[model samples]
Target: MSIGVSANRLELLQIARAVAAEKSIDETIVIEAIEEAIQKAARSRYGAENDIRAKIDPKTGELSLTRNMTVVEEVENESQELTLADAQKIDKTAEIGTVFSDELPPIEFGRVASQTAKQVITQKVREAERQRQFDEYKDRVGEIVNGIVKRVEYGNVIIDLGRAEGIIRRADGIPRENLQNNERVRAYIYDVREEVRGPQIFLSRAHPDFMAALFAQEVPEVYEGIIEIPSVARDPGSRAKIAVISNDGSIDPVGACVGMRGSRVQAVVSELAGEKIDIIPWSDDPATFIVNALQPAEVAKVVLDEEDQRIEVVVPDEQLSLAIGRRGQNVRLASQLTGWSIDILTEEEESERRQKEFAERTQLFIAALDVDEVIAQLLATEGFTDVEEIAYVDLGEIAVIEGFDEDTAEEIQARARDYLERLAAEQDAKRIELGVEDAVLEVEGVDLAMAVKFGENDVKTVDDLAGLVTDDLRGWFETKNGERVREPGILEEFNLSAEDAEMMIMRARVAAGWISEEDLPQPEVDETEAELDAEDAFDVSNMDLAELEAEAEALGLDLDEAAEAEKEAE
Candidate 1:
């Protein structure tokens, strides 16, 4: 930091080159920063209002310093602007808008001036370096990067990544994994952000993709896109499960990821601080995938509820604890990997539950149809859950039941119909007694049972129903005390899907005059009209250059200027 810049031309160029090389920025950026610094110091040495400028030749290291003034009609501030009379004294050809330049001697940097110049240069260089880092790493997200751990402050690791720095926050680091200063580490670049402090490179060792990237490194097939890892679930630093599928029919995805004697997965495990890895072959069938995800345990049967995306898996009595894993970790990882809610039960438990359901259904049929226990048991065993099903089922379905003739089936159907009529009358009475209006029933999809349920929930009229949202009828999840809990909806027991609830609410809104049917979103468009509109659209591509130019001229548009700008853009 001496003031011999003009005398030492080689030193000035060397400093600029070194700073640019070290910061990984363009050499021109370093030169501009130096120019700004010199300009600042020169302004402070001369009057601050003087419009001083400085430039340096990159190759020859030649320096130029000048104070510039603009000629104005009237004298503004004398430092930077002068009247035409004063301008003509300096330059004979000066016009009103002409600029005049006067050469100035090199700045002799004082103590304060030198400090201020250093600050300006440092700030500009730092800004350029930050921008370079952001530009370099912005598109590098989702890739693994290697860096040396710089320091650990309050459990956050700062890494020196050669040209820049990155951080692995406490939450993003593997739990209980110790990272020491100067230690080499590999992390996934999950995010790169331009922040006030600089570019923040957020690295993560706990991200599931970290394991996937490690596999790509260790397995050549994965790296070459021959094998695909569709999903990964990790308990970071403890255990993980990855689902893999092979594009090549002959090669096994699991075997490729496992390598010879598990060397491939072991390498990833070592990097993750000895986390156990389960490599399972992925299947298009979710049940097969879930069964595979829960490694070291066998599932006896899996009943999938596709609508709700839930699967109930029944295991042998001995495999209950194993299937659930230690502290539910096995089932939890399986659920995450398959993207489904899984309910696990032992064989004995499932059998007991089935018997309980059968008994309840039998009792329901007996009470509703006023039939003998034998007939009711026959109906329940044949999968009849309600009187409604029996009343409308084919005559042959019940007549074919053991020891039942067509006459007995007819009698049963009559009883079922009579029972339903009586039930509907009682529910209507309950609905009216609960203050539910007849207008509510007029709304499409609203039956007596639903109206009664609405009245019980204080929704008595069509207007009241119209004011409700989908979540009010389909139930919603809430975060309560650190756990996700399901809050019961008004029609929770009705098993309404979100679309069904929304349709009912919209119908109510129309009946209640809250919204017209036409006001609702029309998701469907007539295909014939859509095709005609497409065919009728005017496309500029059909016009030749001359025709297009004539059209633009007709509209008073300058095609030549636009064509020049378009050429420049190209």
Candidate 2:
């Protein structure tokens, strides 16, 4: 079947089938392309004013050309529309809005017509190819694919992945790995997206999941799910760590991943250009997992700050360099694999830090509770860092402390309570002196210290506090160079939960009258303040009751009419 000028039969179906097979697209798409090209050429050969149509038989490749006219009540255009009186000559029952078709003779393929048809077919085929490429590769994302390096441009490698070309940008390739034309590479398909040109397949050899996929290929146990590779952290071609756990107790996950004489791991290593891998056993306990992640180093102890998701690993002085790796790579990869921030310390450093914490806590107890060094040290050793714990702990707990009798425990508790009260009173006075409004202080959960901090920042009114978000309040105490910085949110001294901070803001809103008390849990009023209000006199010498009510309305206050009745009785 020839596709050329001066041929009796173009064999369009055969040509479409051949092109579809070469381009890896559907045959119907190619047939439509041919029909569109023929239609365009027919419009050019015939008058451009005529409505030309073209169709090709799918099986025989026979071409048909015709002219179509719309039947209208009045013929608006002589070339495209015909009145029903003229349409009835072609068909007796022809009505308005009906299309009339008139068969035309086969188009003679002249030089200009053939050129136009060729260009149209080429354009249609290119568009169909782009659509096909987009559809084919869009769902292949996140899979490991093998491709041949086709070209390199400005540190980017273009890979030919059989049906489509993929790009591995310089940042997505392993560091220091060089590629040549036709070099076979295995990379993870990180993204497949359609753009103006076509679908772009983005490949990455530096992705951490790429290393895990390679292991899954090398280890049958990982592939079969007997041993699970839960997490992987990679430094590209330099090093990586994988945490693996075994569902079956008999099979060792690390041993199975290592294979016989390290053959399986060695295969993956070769593929990754000798990237060293540490296969660590996964554990539910974060401390144990972190200890395992920092392998080849003798860790003496691991202290986990669970709130911060940080781990402090203390090792022998000799193992400090090993635990930190070359330029801290080991600790960095371990932190990534375990999803924790790691701090490596020598045993001597850990001991020194412990002693410093002990001294700080003892000094805090001594200063806050006015206790002697002996009692402060005892409380600090018992893990009481502040006076709050001593003030609020159960009496029995203090009594059970070694060398403490019931009377002595009571004395210590009373002293702690007194100190806290005095400190709070001092802070309250300072907050008032700094011009903090009573409405701001009335908001529940914001202590005197926090109120003083707010006053220092000029957030002195309930409206100001209500306008703030949780983050604004959380950043109140952060400091830089002895001045508040507002970058770090709520340091350990604040002791504010996210919920508590948000609730404080809501309380401020209620106090500011921006929202009603019915919108949230009402704050408890002090009993002493309520009694004092009951005893106070309501003197109306300065203004009448109506004027008082107007002033209260302006201040968003509710005046009790019953209290007015009591004042009248008096």
Candidate 3:
């Protein structure tokens, strides 16, 4: 108990306790601190050139320092190493690589070494205690915690959570929220990590769960099983989308979350410093679910492309801005939450959009034409704006309008029939470009399934069908559009009819020079214009009827002959 003391045991123990207390440490930590302190003292007092060690019993008030010497064949450094014989004198079984120690006389530490030891021991003990503190707090991730504002540094707020300190990064702090040192505030444990200095705790006041938790605290239904929060997507400090389902049929999820006069959600809003939250109903149907996700804006219709996972929403023009949100944030969040690509448009926008679409279609129709704009415009005026429509029109109907005879109408229809052929040839050309298998297009008025079958049949071009006679064409047309012969209907189901079909064939015949101009529509001459031109050039007033008829007959002009005087000489 009374080994002649250098520094007072009471003073050393008191300093160790103080270091441990500063970090809320345990007894073993204090004992380790005591051992480190004594080790420092012995090193400075007796030369560090000599091997020495110190130990303090954790339960008992005991301290000891002894000189330890390694056993060797011969003494190399007389100050540190002892010969094997001498080592065995201390410990009979001492061998090479084994250390033997002997009790040493108590010694005093010098002023400088003593002071240095104090600082070194205090630093080591503080570092040990800090590790212990970090270890204790590391397991608290994902939990709400109460901490006091400690200090602010470089846009980071340091908080003193009761057991450890945490950092609230600038981004995690609520904007414009005041923090006073020592003021208590609650935050969620956003992260827990370790650094060289100590454990790192991250606190956040702007996390989405922060809002949910705030709601749970304020709203009874949300806190209970009556209202369940199914999913949440958020942009901290701006807006968030939360989907809720209700278990109790009587409770409305939105109404319950909103509470009386918006009190429940308003409380959460206040806690989040006015971060807007949209609560939407969760649905098993994705389309319905997306509709809910896009809220406060009414959606007119939702078209979901299941294969692409895309949702095209048609909304009223006034609601487009709302549905898209400011800078498209609303739809972006909705897309993220619903796991679908969203395209939102107003009703008017959709209409204008369709018009542009049809216009493009009409242009494509015109480009496929073998005729002039007059015919294209005429066909469009009759609502045949696409090549498919023209190809399927009957030649009889075509002969009724545009004043084309059967032969010319058939010729026109034949050219219009080339659309599908061209399309198939294009696909085949692309296949050739890709160095894939050679492909061909097949056209039939078959239903979708049968059309696909026909496409596989290699009936690629209208030119291919030109060899087919009228009877074969009739058979194909009937199989495709399900139209009966000569039916009275407002509009034909087939893009082309049998009469139009004949016109297409005849038109092909004309272009091949197989038919004459007389076989086509001739330009009708205006009698009035011809007569006027004749009167301007010739003095027909003095000509006799016989002379006029003879001259008209010779000139290839149809003359209007009146009672005329005889032309005597000539």
What TM-score, computed on C-alpha atoms, does each candidate reach?
0.85, 0.80, 0.62
RMSD per model, one decimal: 14.7, 11.9, 26.6
Per-residue accuracy of model 1 over 313-403 as CA lDDT, tens digit each: 9999999999999888888888878888789999999999999999999999999999989989999999998889999999999999999
Q: Residues 33-146, candidate 2, lDDT per residue (tens digit)?
A: 878877887788788899998887787677778899999997778999999998899899999999978888876666777777888888888888888878887887778999
Best by lDDT: 1
Q: Write the per-residue lDDT of candidate 3 for residues 293-358, one digit (tens) a residue.
A: 999789999888674366789998889899999988899889867777788888888889777866
- The TM-score of predicted model 2 comes to 0.80
Off by over 4 Å in 1: 1-5, 71-78, 83-97, 467-469, 477-485, 512-570
Candidate 3 lDDT score relative to the true structure: 0.69
Candidate 1 least-lDDT 10 residues: 561-570
Model 1 lDDT at residue 26:
93
The C-alpha local distance difference test score for the whole of candidate 1 amounts to 0.89
Task: Kindly indicate the candidate among 2 and 3 with the higher TM-score.
Answer: 2
